[model samples]
Every structure is written in C-alpha cells, then in structure tokens.
Target: MSERVMSGSVDGLITLEAADALWADLTADSAVPTASGAFTCSPAHARMGYVLLGGHAVTTVSASGGQWSVLEVEVRRAAAALNSVGMDRRDLVRIGPFRGAPRLECDEETPLRWRQRIAGELQEPGGPGLAARRAAGRPYHLAGIDWRQMLVEQTRDRTQRTWWLPRAVVRLLDAAEHAETQWVQTTRTRQAGAAAAGAPAPRPYNEELRGQLYSVLSRKPGTARKVAGWACAVCRTAPAAVLDHCHEHGYVRAPLCQSCNTQERPDHLYSNDIRVANHYTRLFHTDTDDWLRHWHRCPGCRARTTLPLPHLAAWTAHIACRSLRPTHRAPRGRKPCGVLRVSWTGSQNTPRSCLITVAVDCCPSGEHRVLAQVSYREAAERFRVWLAETAPAVAAAAGPDRLDGLPAQLRPVIADTDGEGLALF
Candidate 1:
C-alpha cells in the first residue's frame, strides 16, 4: 500500500500499461483474489469505478486497492458521519442505542478520493474489468464477515488506533468460521423451520429472503400483523421478513429481515468481537458509566457493559438484594429472570400529547426499559461532566490522530473543532 506510482501511470491514457506495471494483470496473479475478494490489480492501476447499491450509483476513486477500497470508504463515511467527524453534528441521525438500536446516520456526502495513486486492487473472481461483470454482476464478500461493518466500528473507536484493529479483524474471521453453531444462525434456522410447518408468520415474514437485516424509525413490533395491510419498512429490494424487538425491553421496533435480527444482537461480542461496536462511541459508554445513576441509588449497571460492542444495558437493580427481586419465569432458564413486567403511562411534556410510560421494573434484570428519553441537548449535558474529566487523558493519548488525517478542505466544511482536540460528541 505504501508503494507510489507516477501521475501518468494513473491517468486513463496510460492505465493499461500502468496496470501491467503494478500488477501481474497478464499473468495468473490477476485471476486470483484475496480472502476479502480483493484482486491483483496492477500496482500502477489507481482505481476509479462505480457500483450500484440499492439502485443508487456509488462512484469513488481509490488509490491502489480497487473495489475493496471503495467499500472500506463507505464504512468510514458512515462512522465519520455518526461521530460527526468533520461533519455537522446536527446531521447525525441517531435512532437509539442498546443491543438493538436499529440505525445511525448523518447527511450523506460524496466520499473523498485518494489524492495519491497507490498500489492495491480488488476484483471479482471473474477477473478484472468487463470480464468480472460478465461472470458475476455483484461483488462478493467473505461469508459472515461484513468488512464494511467491522470497519465502521473501527473508525468510531479513535481511542485505540492500529493497536486493536488486528484483534478485531481476527475475531471477525473466527466468527465466520464458527458461525454454524451460533445463536444468530441456529435461532434463525429454528424459526424458519417452525414457519415451514405452518406457524402464523404473518405477511412480511412470509415474503422476502428468510434472513435479511433491516432498520426503521419506529421500534414497534411487527408480528401477527397482516403484511398485505401495510408495507414493511425496508431499504432493500427484499420485502419485510419478520418483526424486530428488543428482547430486553419487550418493545417491538419493526418487521425486520434476518439480516437486521443479527445486527440487533450485540451479544455477539461475548463470543466474538466481530469488530462491530454499538451505535454509541467509546466516549458515550464512558460517560454513561460514570453517570446515568439509578433512581434508587443502586449499581449504575452501565459500567457492567462490555466493549468493543458496548452501550449495551448492564444488569441493574433497585436495591442491593437480588433475592427479593426474582425475574419472570419463561420457557428457557435463560429466557426468564423471575422479574415482573410492571408498566404504566403518563404525559412527559404537553398534556396527553407527549405521553411517557415509566416502567419501574425493580427486578434486577439488566434491561432498564424506559419509554421516554431526554432531548439531545439534555442528554449531551449528562456527558459533559465525564468528557471534562477525561479530556486531559484523551488529548494526551498522543500520536497521529483521526483529525490529523483529514483533508484541509474538509475541516471547515464538515469538521467542528474546539481547543480540546477533535470533539465529536
């Protein structure tokens, strides 16, 4: 990746010759692809290409690596937008954050192009250029390893630069290897089998690929509902697959595909990092831990949450004694906590307009289900104390940082900076 090529080598006129110079395009190497489906583009071949995603044209310029580079860029852009890195903080679209927060985003922008032409290429198995498309229309990703997703998490964690990346990547591969027995796979299979035997799967779940991922604004449950009555919220060609809900809160979000179900479960972190962090930043977790205290003055539980997949609700309690607070019993020993599902509703803001249901489930079950949440500025204030305490340590964790890498043009337009380094709440 460090190798440099001449400007003429990158231009379209000399591209073929350049491709041959950097990569063994004429040889067998050109035919082979890396584990991630990266091909042997000639080192001299700086890539400029476009791919269609969800019916939209995605064009980007990659320095060395071909198509793979483009995908990596997308993941970073997503995280950069989420963290508001060199971007408007107002543009960030945060749905919610738990093990099951559905989506996160910011105003999209045309991704930046690599200023220098480097030496890396990724192509399909069909080979490079026209030949690849002739064989397979879409690019391939390693099974179970969503590289773009892994990178989105990597990009968010500015705290650990290159140090943790290898471990994260290795965990992703390990997960792929062991995916067959995992709950994400097995549970889907079990549910699918039940449906095949004539369970009431409703409409959305009946259609579409059995296991696709999804996101939506509403976190309402989507089961037993007639699909024909309404269209399931989806961003892909696939229709709704099934309902999505937070197992902890017992609140349904939307009808989701198999793909979305897997994303909702950050418990994948306990067995495998998969390199995918939660929707919140590392700083967010740190803040929640130090604050967000329980009303009864029990353990915060926030600190109990783990990372690289974090912001997951930690086990909480109203009192020090778990014996008095048993969870509700369910079929599986793991399913029930002998806790109660005590809930009621009331207004938060306008009379009867902004209704808020506060459930005081003192069951010591880790899931703290609050129906209403505070405004952004109010929530942001909650973190200010923590941010101030750690600002010195964060700033002093010295070395080349994410801010230093941004192009100067991006700083003013997208990045908002203050005296305390690159502050993206």
Candidate 2:
C-alpha cells in the first residue's frame, strides 16, 4: 500500500493576540491589523469569546458559506484571557515618569507597577485608585468608549484576523481540530452502538477506498489510496452514518446507513448528489474528461474496481473515449485469442505489461481471413500517437496560435504510421 505523500508544511503559534487577529481578519470585512503579531494564541481563547474571538472565517473555497464554529470558540477563549490579565489603554501612562516634565507624583520606574496597575484597573469591576483601577474588573465609561470596555474590545479585536495565519498553518490547525473531533465522535458512537447491540465494531475494508476519498478532499494531487486514508480519517465511521462511495470514474455511489442496510431495505442504494458534485468540482480543472471514462461501470460494484479513486493521468486517458460507441464484438466463428504474454524493456522499473490480442479467422466458409495479431502495447502506443496528433487540432479550436499544455503522463505514446492521427496497430 502506498503512503499519503506530504505536500506542504504545518505551522503552530502560542501568542494569544496573534490568533485573535487572524480569526478577525478571516471573518470580518475591512478588518484592521491587531496590535500584536502572534498568529494563533491558545485554542482556549476562541472558546470563551465566541462572537468577538473566532468568528466565521472560511478558508476553503467549498467552505465559504459554511460555518466554522471551532475558530469562533478559540476567539472567545482569547477574550477570556485578556479579561483575566487586566491589560488596558490607561496603563500606558505608567511607563514614563512625568511624561517629559521634571517629575511626576507617581513613581513610573517599575514595569511590574505598570503591569499591576493595568491589571488592577481592568480586572476589578469598579475603579478604587491608580493601583486598584488596573486590577481585573469591568471598565468605566469615557468619550463613548469606556477604558475598561476598550480593553475588553482590544482582546476580541485581535481574534478576527483569520487570513493573517500562513496557509499551511491554517490547514494544519483545521486538520488538527477536524481529526480530534472525528476521533471523539467515532469512538463515542462505536462504544455506544457496541454497548447497545453487544457486538464489536467493524474493521476498515482492506481495500483502498479510504485513500480515494482523501484525494478528493486534499489540495495535493494524489493516488486513490492516499485520498481514501484522509477521507476515512476525516469522516469517522463509528457514527453509523450512511457511507458515500465515490468511484474513480465521475460517478459517486449512494450512502448506505447501517440500520438501513440491516433492517430497512438491504438492496436499495441512496445517492448523494452533493458528495458527487463536491468531488467533481475539486478536480474539475485538473482532469475533467478522464474521470468520466474510467468509472464507466456502476460505482456500487466494489469488487470490479479495487481502488476507490483513480489517478489523474489514467482518468484523463479514459475520459477521452467515454462517449465513443463500441464498433463491434469479435466474431463467434474465429478461434478465441487468449491473453498475450507481453515482454518489455521498461518492465523492471514500473513492472507493467500490455495484454495484446488481435482478430483472427477460423471459419470454414473461406470468408474469414486473418485480420491482424498486434500486441496491446502496440495498440496503446498507437493510441498515444493518435492522441498527440489530434490534441493540437482540438486545442487549436479555441485559438490557432494557442499552445496546448498537456501533462507529461498524458503525452500519448506515438506510433510510426505517417502521424496522420490514425489508430493503427
């Protein structure tokens, strides 16, 4: 089994203010920068200040209209921290002695004094004195903005900058939260179900379906196996929710809830147009045509297709001929051609061979004649050549001068037959 390949990096931060700012930027329009530079403070910050902290900030294109509650939770928690710390605007004056004047009535030589004074005024509910005012409390009103209220406001101000975090960091954080929640949900559901039914949980299918799902979700281009793993992990199965099976081809199979499978209608399958649409959109620009061709059979037939999803290159090749009608079947009178034993030079590296066969004549009427005996490799090579020749013309339809940028894996295996774009083997 191939492993999921890492396509990017992960980022983490401890600064509370930074997290708040990032949360704000992502959710709010015309958002300003936070006073501090931290990207992601503690997750706790988001939980406490729900509205002020982590608000709605959708990073994924698909998630744009969806709500991201976890981010909001983190922001609220950050506000809680600010309230606990008692930092406010008035505390700035405590930094200098007399502010360029000869001397001030208060001693401004201590940083601890400033912190304490600031903390006292903000932390306490009411102001007692210069020192008592800095303690944690509700703030007093001034110029339509109470100093204490402003202090509380600043904490939330930082949480709104969601786009401030690096792309990798945002994904990693999102993944972490998703994983944690999924795991918890899966574990709890399985435990409850097992207790209720007195049976153990089912194991993952030994097949590569899990990896295929991951490919659809992840930004990285990948094989079916890699995609399946991520998809499985993201959609924890212990919850007894219906399963959505997606074929490498364009089709997505229906969801089969456990109870529905066992009790209601065992033979029935329910399709989820949303999942299919989502998968199609993700790789639409990447390999639109190929996927349509490869997944020709009904997606429900699990045994026919081993991997859950298809490689972009292979899918691309398949999609080109999806709409073509079959010409004819082999004549019954002809002796059946068995699978050809293909030998090739590149066999050691990729270790794959083409199954070759050709039409032959075995009829007594003398009408049957030996048509050909070409190897599948020859057919494929010829097909590739035809693809290359016609691709330019096809691409030219948009504009005669425009160059077609085909992927390397799809640079059709050309044939030697006059390059007329004909499929001759």
Q: 156-191, model 2: which lDDT tens digit per residue?
A: 366431112222222222333333333344555667
Native-to-model Cα distance after best TM-score fit, residue 406 in candidate 2, in Å:
30
- Model 1: lDDT equals 0.27
TM-score of each: 0.22, 0.21
How many collisions per candidate?
Answer: 30, 74
In model 2, how large is the Cα lDDT of residue 379? 44
Candidate 1 lDDT over 1-425, as tens digits, reads: 11332343333322322322322222223111222222222211124343222112223355554422333333223223222212222222111111223322211221211101100112224322333344442432232122222221222356531111123333333333333223233454477777787643334323332112222322235422333232343333333444543221222334544343343333222221111233223223443332222100111111111111112221111111223333566666533233222211221112233221222233446665443333323322333333335443432322223233222221111121211110111
Residue 423's lDDT in candidate 2 = 10
